[model samples]
Each structure stands twice: as C-alpha cells, then as structure tokens.
Target chain A: MNARAEFHDPATRAHLLADKARWVREQTLAIHRRAPETRVASSLSAVELLTVLYYSGIARITPDEPLHAERDRIIISKGHGSICMYPILADCGYFPMAALETVCKPGSFLGGIPDPIIPGYETINGSLGHGLGVGSGTALALRTKGKAQRTFVLLGDGELNEGAVWEALMFAAHHQLKNLIAMVDCNGRQMLGYTDSVVNLNPLDAKFAAFGWQTHTVEDGHDVAQLLAGFEALLASDSPKPKVLIANTLKGKGVASLENAPLAHVMGVGRAEIDAILGDGAAP
Target chain B: MKTTMRDTFLATVLEEMQASPDVVLLSADFGAPAIDAIRAEFSDRFVNVGIAEQNLINLATGFALEGFRVIGYAIAPFITMRCFEQIRVSLAILSQLRPMNVTLVGVGAGFSYDVSGPTHHCIEDLAVMSALPNLSVYSLSDHTQAPLFAKHCLAKPGIKYLRFDAKPHEPVCDAGNDGLIERGFRVLNAGRDLAIVSTGYMSHVAWSLLPELRAEGIDPLLIDLVAYNCVDTAALEAELAHVPRTLLLQEAVLDRSIENTLRRMAGGKLEAMGVGDRYIFEIGSRDQIHDAAGIGRAQVLDRILQHHAALA
Candidate 1:
C-alpha cells in the first residue's frame, strides 16, 4: 500500500472517507453484537473522527503495527469513545479483528473503555480531561527530539468543564506548540443534558482565542470534506499556539432513528435496532 | 544537622542525570537555588512545573511513558497526597514494567515545618505511601543517607517515596561509609533495657539522648530504620525480644507509624512518642512542635525512663 495513495486525489480521499465511515458503523455494530450487555452508544460520533484520521489523515499507522514510533499519536481524551476507537484499532490491525468480540468479557483487555496494554491504545483513559496533558508532554518530547510527528487529541465537549484541560491548553499555547492539534467533539449533549443546560460554553471559539490558540469550528462534523479542510487549514498555519478544531456533530449521527436522540447516549442497539439501522433485510 | 542532606540529594540527582540522559528532574516550583546548578550541569533534564501538583505528576508520567526516568520532587503532601491519583494511575500503573521514581522530599516528618501549619506537616505520609502497592517508602535519618538511598532508587525500577527533613541532620552515620545502606544499623547500643526505634531526622535526637540514658544506667538501644516500607520484621522482632519496653519515636503522628509497628510486634509493650492527634494550634519553630508532641530528646528519655522503672 503506497502511503500517499490513500489520500492522493480528492476523489480517492472522498472514497476513503466513505469507506472508513462504513467501517466505523460496521465495527460499532460488531462491538454491540459481541458484547450485548456493554454500554457502547455514547461515542458513535467518535467513530467518524477516528475513521477520518486513521483512513485519510496524516497518522502513519499500520493496523498490524500500532506501536511504530514514527506514527502520529491519537489520544482519545473522551475515553467513553473507546467503543469507536477499539474497532478502528482492530481494523488498523493492532489486534486480531476478532478479539474485539471479547470486549467487556469476564477477563478481556477490551473493557468498557480504553486500556494502553491493549495493542494500539496509548493511554488508559476513562476519566475525562487527561488526554491533552499527556498529549502535550508527548508533543513536547517530540519537539525536544526534533521529530516531525504530530499529535492529535480528541476531547469531549463535556470535558471542557474541567480546569485541568484549560491549564493544559494555556501551557500548550504558552509554549507555542504548533505540532499539536486538539479537536473538541462538540456533540452539545452530555450525560445529564445539553452542554448549554450544564455550563453553556456558547462562545467556545472566543474562549480558545483568549487562551492563545488558533481556533476553527466546523458546522457539520459528519462532512468529511469540511473535516479534511479544517485539518488542512490547521496544518497550513504557522501559528505559534496549538490549534483547536471544534467539530459540531450530532450525538448519534449515522442511523436515522438514533440521530440527535440523546437516549442513544447510554442505550445499546439490540438485534432489531441493528437490523433497522443496517436495512430491513440486513443479517443479525 | 544542617543543609548537607539537601546538597547531597541534589548532587546525587545531578550525577544520575549525567550517567542516564533520560533522567528528568521535575520540581513543584521549589528548589530554584539548585536550578542554575542543574541547568549548568544537566540542561535538558530539568523542568520546574510551577505549583501545579497534579500537572507535575501527569507530566512526569508523560515523560516516563516517553522512556525517560522521571523524578518528581516536592514536599511530602504535594507529591504524595495532592496528586495521588496521577501517581497511582500514571507512574504506578503506566510505568509498572519499568516504574518511574517519584522522590518526595521535604516531608515534615513530625513538624519539620512546625510553623507551616497542618498543611505542611506530613504526619500521615507514611501511612499514605505504605498503602500503595508498588511504591517503596524511605524516611532518611540524616544527610548522608539521602544520596545513598537516592542512588539506589534511581537505579532500581519502581515508584519510591523518599521523606527527608529540609534542614541538615546530625551525621548519624558516616557519609563515606555504606554500612547504613546495606544493613539497617543500631547507631547506639545500650544493652537492650529499652529500645528507641527512630526514623527520619528524629533519629539524631534519639541517638543524642542515648549517652544521657547510659549515664543514668538506663540502657536505651537506638535503631535507625532507614527504609520504612521494607523494614526487617525479623530484626525488629529480635530487638523487641531483648528489650522489655520499646519507644517508637517519629516527627509525625503517633498513631500510624508507632502504633502499626507495635501492632506488628504484638508481644512488645510499645509507647509512641510524636505529635498529638490534633493539629498544632500555635505557630512556632520545628523544635516547638517536637516539644509539643513530646518526641524531643528530653521527652523521649523521660518517657523511656518512666516506662522502664514501671516494669522494674
């Protein structure tokens, strides 16, 4: 596989994006099929972001070999999104794709959240608001070593409430770390209710701006073109501060019945729901 | 006791950094005087994470994850209790295969910072550190012991909590000698009428009172317990067997350190000498708190004589 061939042309990029999105859905469905009891719905939107990065973005990863040093780092700060990340890692070839079947099993590495001991996971994170700090350190290490590798961290909108996250943001911005990019999965809804109802981070762009970060917001997170464009714009900028790509997305994006349904935050898809999402005649 | 222990600790850390380029020193914004020395000596290996205890631990963990041997330095409470979760998760669990060393200095073992109030007093640090599974806790008795134990901690793989008083302590053991490091030594031998088990800076006071006790025909044995967590239980039991009464002296609270030791040697009659259960209400020097806690040399000697006389 020529590394450049995955995203050489616009047409190819689009096809890869669609294929990765489908793969994300299929993998998510597989997680549900394997562990019928696990809560795997809160992070459906994470699948889109993981797919976009792994399949078409700059991370140099071979699914079979996730620990490759030169590969870009993807730290999922929103650890609840493990449901989305584990399958992508399996697809990337970190583990036997079938091992995902043991997710949340009695004694399996694949628990309800990410564990670094598992082949591709970088940091064992289930607690929110820790990824950026770890990522900052990794980015700093890379800079000190003069490595060209970049670090991409996925943070949940709910996690912004934590003061440690902002402390990390300020630290990254003060250091002017251009090699690091932080993406906030702005799904609006949290466990209790909408983000507005909880703490109302209405002007997130200005907040990032105030913190000395180069900030951008996407209206449609599911739009691969926009996601890629935002990433490209970030890569092109020579801004001394770190970048924050605010991806505004629906809670449950792909399946029509589950789209914008807050109940999907904790609800799992059964055989009937899975069939309905895949199509009426789809196999269980 | 002076500032030799601080100097020795800093010097040994610099030496370790020179040998292993991967060694990084993270301070919770303390020890600025040593900064120029470290920078002039080992430039790339030092980071002063300002006052953020949680960030300090996480950053160290991050460095450890990047294959660097990180040493997080701070006063006891800040390093151990403040960012405990980070220590437990990041350094303890993440670096379990080759665990990073986080050396907590300036632990107010029995009111080292008597005037800094309850917050600065690290009385329960031993209890807190001992509870952690993969961590080794050491309370250095004097300045000479600091460097020796530090070198061992740096070379060995795991989390180690090192508690030391900031000021210089009386030379309980010779700096050139490695006897204390290899085997836990009895600095003062008084034929076992009574034994005083001392840790950290208070061991000096315990040793100092031995001559007075011997003059009074109260033979008090002085045992310097260097490594608190890995204490030789058999040796302790043997020492307890000869003495009719044992006095556990510390600079911290009496309950956990002394009480736990006594509980372990159930047969021995133990009297704990240290700070009372309540926080020190009045502000004064370290000596004042030691006096208040009744762990000072005079207080310890009086208690020992009284206990021994009662048994006779």
Candidate 2:
C-alpha cells in the first residue's frame, strides 16, 4: 500500500501533522520529566521539522529493516536536540513504545545523546557539525552505486558555526550532490544565548546560497503545511546542486517560560508544569 | 632502488581500488607522485577534500558507515592532531558500534620533513594514535612493508592509522616473508646480548647502528614492530625471553613513546631511547635534528654501549 496516499488530502494531512506535533511535544515534555538531562528546548524547536519528515511520507524508512539498503538515510546531526525523535521513532515501531520509559535510565540504549545503537539513527551524533559531511558521503556513495535513495541531515542553526560544516557545504556543492538535502532548524537560540548575539548568522539563506546550494526558506517553520510544502518542492527539484531548507523557527516553541528564557537550552520543565500542559495525556 | 613508503603503499591502494568497487580514497590535499596515477585512473572514486582534515575524516567515516572501505590520506601532524576529535568521535568511537573499514594514511613520520620546520614533525603521533582504544597504529619501517600493510588494511574491518615515512629507503624486510608482517614484528637479526626494538624510520636507524654496535663487541637484535596494537604478544614474549636487555628506540618524543609499550611488555628489562621531551627548533638535516633532540647516531650508540655495560 502507498503510505503517501492517505496524506493526499491537504486538510486531513494538516490536521494529522498538527496533531502529531502536539503529541510529540507532550511526549518530549513527559520524557524530560523523566530524564531532565535531555535537551527539551532544542528538541522542541525541531518537533515540527521532524514531524513533517517522518509523517509526511517523504523519508523512505522501514521499521522492520531500519538499515535496509534501499531506505533513505537520515542523520540527526544535532543529536542532543533530538530527544523528540525517540517518541516519534517508537510511535513508528522502530522500537517497543514501552522502552520510552527507560530513556536515560540505567542500561537503556536511549541516552541524553543518541548513538547509532538506536535502530533508526544512522550515525553517532551529539557532536555538532558532523552530519552534513557524513550525509554527503552517503549521498555520494548512493549516487556512485546507481541508487536513487537520498540522504537527509537535520542540523541546528548554531551547528553552522563549525567550520567542518562549511567544508562539507563546499564539497557537496562542488560535487553536485543533488541527492543530498540539509534541513537546518533555524531556532535563534543556542545554549548560552541567541545565535545572533553569540555569532550573527543573520542572513542564513544567503550564506547557503553563496555557498552554491539550492536554498529554500519557510518563514513559519512551526506551520506543518509550510514545512511540508518547502520540503517537498526542494526534494522534487531536479537541480544538480545540493539543497538546503532554512526553516526559521522559535526555540522552545510551545512552552511560554522556556520560549522567552535566554538560557532555555539548559532549562528543564518541571513535572508539575508538564502535567499542567499535558493534562490528560496517558503515559506511553 | 629506494622508493618512498607512500608511493609503494598508495600503489597498492590503487590496486585495491581496481579490484573492489567498494574502495574509496579520500585525500586532504596531501599527495605523492603515486597519488597522481590514482587521480588520473580512478577519478570518480578518488576524492580530494582540499586541506580540510576534519571533513576528510568525517567523510571517510560516512563512506565506511555505508559499507565502503575508505582510505583517508593527509600529512601526519594535521591528520592526527588537527582533526583529533573527528577521528575520536567518528572513526574510533563510531567504529565500536558499527562495522567499518577505514584506514587513515598519515605521511611524514617524525622528522621526515626536517627542513619544513616543527609543524611538519610528527613526533607525537605514535603516542596519540596508539592511545585510541580501537584504532591500530601501523608504523612502516621500509618500502617493502608498505604493500603488505596496504593488503592488511583491506583484509581488516576496523579503524587503522598508517604512519608512513616521507623519505624513501631500501627494502628492509627479507623477500617472501609476509608471515612476519602478520605477526606485527620481525626479528631483523638474532643476537643474544641486546635487542633494540623500534618502528618506522627509527628501525632504519637501528639497522644502521647494528654493525657499529657489533664492532663494539655488543651483539644487538633488531625487531621492527610494524603493527602497534595487533601484535602476537606470545611470539614477541618468546623472542624477548632470552635477551637479557632490550633498548626501545623511536624517532619520536619520550613522553608516551611506543617504546613505553615495549618496555612494559619486556617485563621492565628494557630502556627507552627517543627524542627529548621537547620540540626541536634547530634547522638541520634529519640526523642534526636528531642530534638536537638527543637521538643522534652517536648519542644512540653511546646509550647502547652504556646500557650494554650495565647489563654486563
């Protein structure tokens, strides 16, 4: 059965994506309530982006065979900011949903930073600025082997500070890796402060454009429809250049306290606050 | 005829690339004459990532993760030190979880680039590369060992670092003796008095000093330890069992020297000789730089004679 067929209705797909985003946010907060070590704000910033990718049927993945040769590879480079992935992956049957409770606990494979030990994860992450180059390599490999599978990497806006990312940026463009897609969760805030105040990457899209990438920007990253539209257009484009989607997003999108906090990256939501937000949601 | 280890090793890599469709060579803008042929012949598979060492390693890790055997090449100090965290995180740490075949070939061991100044001197690589848990450090002594080590890389499914000397030297290993290469060491000469254990370029130095030591009435054994971590310790222990005293020498710093490992394995019956625990700033020939670093030929002979005297 074609999984993408169900989401062809714009209204129904929008409703389903928005609903999944809400569930993911609630699950993220609930997971943080159990494992405070998880980066809640960073994870929250990327919830919509991840939801669009996993639920929109754009990423070709099989829970039964996570590392299947034909599957499109997704590298969550900003690993610490991807705690939201654990719940979504569990919901997709990548692992037992019951294992979500043991996240960051003793002997659990799920740590604060995700490794390739998880079935769905493609690379060792948490160390920023590694995913793009790795994804480029995979894209190159797939292209070399005459495979049509694409390689996607989710990066943080702050991760662009790493010079290695630029090296890969130059490489992918020069090599004309059209099969590679980079989605940057342009959440303004970094750990200590806003990326603008820390090191201004004000014209993010232009920077990628200047690097010779086919660039796209979604003014409202939280809007699932906008994200899905931007992603699908970029994915479908036949341009020989590598593509990047700059989704300008808000850090700590839903929670008010964290949304305004300068140090939201390190701030953890209290159990009571989480209970208040997700009043009647059952624990996974 | 003498040939640079990089040329011989890369020549073998060129063969591997021809034989296997899964092999890919990534370079960090560091090249040799042999690489020119690879670039011309296998342009599709040969990638020059410019002078970016970190990306060189990360890209190689990406290829290896996708079941491609990767050979990443670069200058010694920059490859091991400039992108250390990348190697640690991507290759060394990631390989523990995934099956990877990535061999990083670092040229210019020790003072091979003597005239290029201190930055090119890769004296600390032995200590740093060997410190990583899962990575094997292959220190090639001569051009003869390069092809074998290159083949060893294709057969192994783990992370490895090949410390190839920039200069060329005559074949040191006897012809048709790959068995010794697999054992990770070769007893160049058997002498009951003293065994001078070394690796890479220092093995050449030890080979040169052998007859002089013998003339001084102190018969010495030369063991070129090629593979740093994948050694047959039982065989090595048996070889060192009868030797009364051993001198561990390397053309590198004494702090965390490869000699330190040999000293431990020899049951404290060994002394280590290497460059002083400081960088050499004096501009001179390789031997003169060695003189400044206190590992010169005369200094090494004197140390060997003193050690032999103490043993007597």
A85-167 per-residue lDDT for model 1 (tens digits): 77777766678777777776644667776667677677756777778887887777677667888888999898888777776
Q: Which candidate's DockQ is highest?
A: 2
In angstroms, the error of model 1 at B252 is 3.1
- TM-score for chain B in model 1: 0.76
TM-score of each: 0.84, 0.89
Predicted structure with the largest lDDT when compared to the true one: 2
In angstroms, the error of model 2 at B310 is 30
Task: Return the interface RMSD of the candidates, in order shown, one decimal each.
Answer: 13.8, 13.5
Over 4 Å off in model 1, which ranges?
A2-9, A62-64, A255-264, A279-284, B40-43, B97-110, B173-191, B232-246, B254-312
Q: Can you give the lDDT of residue B50 in candidate 1?
A: 72
Tens-place lDDT digits, model 2, residues B1-312: 699998989899999999999999999998889899999998889999999999899899888888899999999999999999899888887887788999999999999998999999999888888778779888888888888889888889989999989987787656334566658888888888988889888887888887798899988778888886668899888899889888888888765556767877887688777655333334345777788878899999999999999999
Error of 1 at B284 (Å): 55
Q: Please state what fraction of the native interface contacts candidate 1 reproduces.
A: 0.21
